[model samples]
Target: MLISTSKSLFSSLIISTRNTSNLFIGKNVRLRNYHNKFPLAGIKVTVLKEPFNSQLIPKLFENFGAEITIFCDTSNIKKQSIDLNLTNSDFVKAEVFGTKVTPKKYIEAGEREIDLSVDGDLNVLKKYAIKSDIFINLENKRFGEIGFNPEEIIKLNPKLIFANISNFNQTNSKFVFVKENMNEEYLELLHQNSKTLFTLGEISCFTKILLTLFNKQNSGKGQILNLSISDSLLHLNRLTSPLLLSIPNAFDRFYLTKDKKVFSLCLPTINDQQKFLKNLNLTNSKEMSAKIAEFDLSELNMFLKGSLCVCIC
Candidate 1:
């Protein structure tokens, strides 16, 4: 997710820019939270393309809101199109990896997928993006020039990458990208917030742009490698304006102890949480949970819910 401060518009824009919105798969915590926050309230939401999340929209009024409205993606208004922002566009050849490598093959060597499409080509994608007060980019596919013109795509990435961040970076906003894979607690927070927001795929060069956009001066400017909260912030001078602190999380951790679904789709319990913890040597390092302290992996939810907001540096 991107958190950008627009000095011109004068607003703190925090947004999620990924397709995880589909993860709701008939359930939306945002809607759930909205109901809890303001019962029978009418809030405006704009979704692009897929009508998956509409599951929650149909029955919203039964519980709250004087009127349920759709301002974008009106195709599913009957189901739950609160806001509509449809646009005209043409289909572009899907760039699976910004390279010649397909996702499945890339992962065989332990990699991630990223693809891209151009504005006129990705017209549908671009159209949906600009419509939002805060555009969200669901890394549907990262397109890049794998062979001859990679920069063609790389250049496209920083610009086409939609989010409140782009709005700010387009204007040059100060921000931070924290890195510390050893961290699981705050890491989850970053993941939870940004999983649907910012995407770097697997390539670090593209990632550099992703990072620099927070605030950069070309030539690897505003980019920090091997992210660590303390070290990254240390390099950043005090900012006169609000800063967008972004942490990358989605899947670097494999431990699953607290997750209600320890085994998705009947998959065997892959890693023993306790053994995983013990292996981490966190007991000797800074930690919070005794479960984690004891060196045992646990449910993702358990590890998360028992998560300590304060880190045990």
Candidate 2:
């Protein structure tokens, strides 16, 4: 099966177990990760470079033993932040074979700014999209009659794992939304603190795709995972939002110590506040920052025992 995380390297050991010998079709070595626990091991994986997010796939799936082939214009490879010679070494740490495609895409756009929305020919890119089991579409443009079409690519490769990453939200049947898992009152409080009353989009979408990949690998099904940037951030709000709402005035309750360390004190009730003072010799909210900064995490944990206060810094 497809074990997505670094923690579970052998839940279904796709690389060493699966019979995917026919999938290794190319020979040009481009990007490589050499981790002992390769998740996408034995599968010939192709990454489309251009979209900013496509650049992240190799690192994300590095330990999963997939022979990763980056399909991009050769110049794009040079544009990466890391030195060219060190690229192979980085992949080796992740435990996978990495390579790139030849007869590159953008030629005239060299050193000149090229908009991914209109840079390469859609027809040619489509062929590369379904070339492997998993296709990472970071094409920073909309998909349609004139753009990168998702539906069309699936038709070309029915078993392809297609992931479209862009700035905003996109919809598809395979995409799943994570539950916020918070009380109604807590959500309302968090909504007031945020601009659009939504979670950070990038974090949420990333988590959703990870969960989807895990499920798909276990089932051997091609899936489409869609996540909105805003909604995803909201999912994470469940951790800190409730604590902030428990206090009298959350925004004001946040304090900065003399040493420039920031922390929050959320006391749900007067008894809890009294207990906090009795247990830690902390009288007023003003003394909290300095007192907390003086103590280590273990000391703080002890003070928080049998207490309703949420100490977050």
Candidate 3:
């Protein structure tokens, strides 16, 4: 009788696993179909040299269904355009930025080919600028220096949104000298990492541009937006309290298990911390670490299931 009951339970588990697998497969098929109708459909965006030559910003616009026209100098036009194509590699590498992104297979089939053009001649930019709803310039040069005037473009298209990406706020007098003389070494020292400051700044700038676009849709207005890498780094630094330095391990956000696998722990509020301590019957992170060390990663995951403590392993 005992053997029969165990066999019955094992069979049920196998059936449940198969059902879950099929459900996920069906969901993925639905997601692939959903990309046919994107939120930014019919939006015309003109991108002039991506920030730090990362190619990520334009890809974001493409992913959301915008018609993208990317203009680069004669030297980089071909290379940048080729990089936009979806490759069959296991990971997508942003070679210039020194980062590898996780493969998102869903976007591969739906991506439209980008329109590339040489940006040296003012006539070409003027032709597209007049028709573009959104204009992004990350070249770090004034419009006049680039061969055209922003006022002329605005006059032609009053509802055009312009996003300027730079290393420092151009209008601020204090950062004017630094912006002109800034080099790779100075940037690395400022953020204590190479290229991370630019990456963060670009993402923040992209988010702000999207918010501005949302506002423009309702208000029927266009505006100029500016983002600086230095300002983005400063904003992030301000979030860390100076008093945190006095506490031991106050900044530790990850813990190790018996199997040597690391996982993140997030207790954002006092209530969350209290709930985590009560659920684990522990008073501090040290105790939590000791407790976690007793189990392998798989066992720890099972142990913490349905608990208030937010953990990612």
Tens digits of per-residue lDDT for model 2, 1-313? 3343433633443343234455663564222332445544555555554412223345555445665656443333334443335432243322222443211223222122333345564455566667666665443333452356677677876666776555342432111211221211222333222313232344345445555655665675676644344334423443656654434442123333233222334566778777766666866655554565576444544766787654322
List TM-scores for all candidates, in order. 0.23, 0.43, 0.47
Measured by lDDT, the strongest candidate is: 3
lDDT of 3 by residue, 74-162 (tens): 32222432334444232222322234332223122323222233353556777787888899875656555666677778887878898
- After TM-score superposition, the amount by which residue 248's alpha carbon in candidate 2 deviates from its true location, in angstroms, is 15
- Of the two candidates 1 and 2, the one with more favorable lDDT, higher being better, is 2
Candidate 2 regions exceeding 4 Å error are 1-10, 13-36, 44-57, 69-120, 169-207, 239-313
> Pick by TM-score: which candidate is best?
3
Report, for every candidate in turn, its global Cα lDDT versus the true structure: 0.24, 0.45, 0.52
Which digits, one per residue and each the tens of the lDDT, describe model 1 over residues 241-303?
Answer: 122122111112222223211111111122333333444444431242333323323333344
lDDT of 3 at 243: 32
Is 1 or 3 the stronger prediction by lDDT?
3
Candidate 2: worst-modelled 10 consecutive residues by lDDT: 173-182
Error of 3 at 291 (Å): 45
The Cα error of candidate 1 at residue 310, in Å, is 5.5
Better of 1 and 2 by TM-score: 2
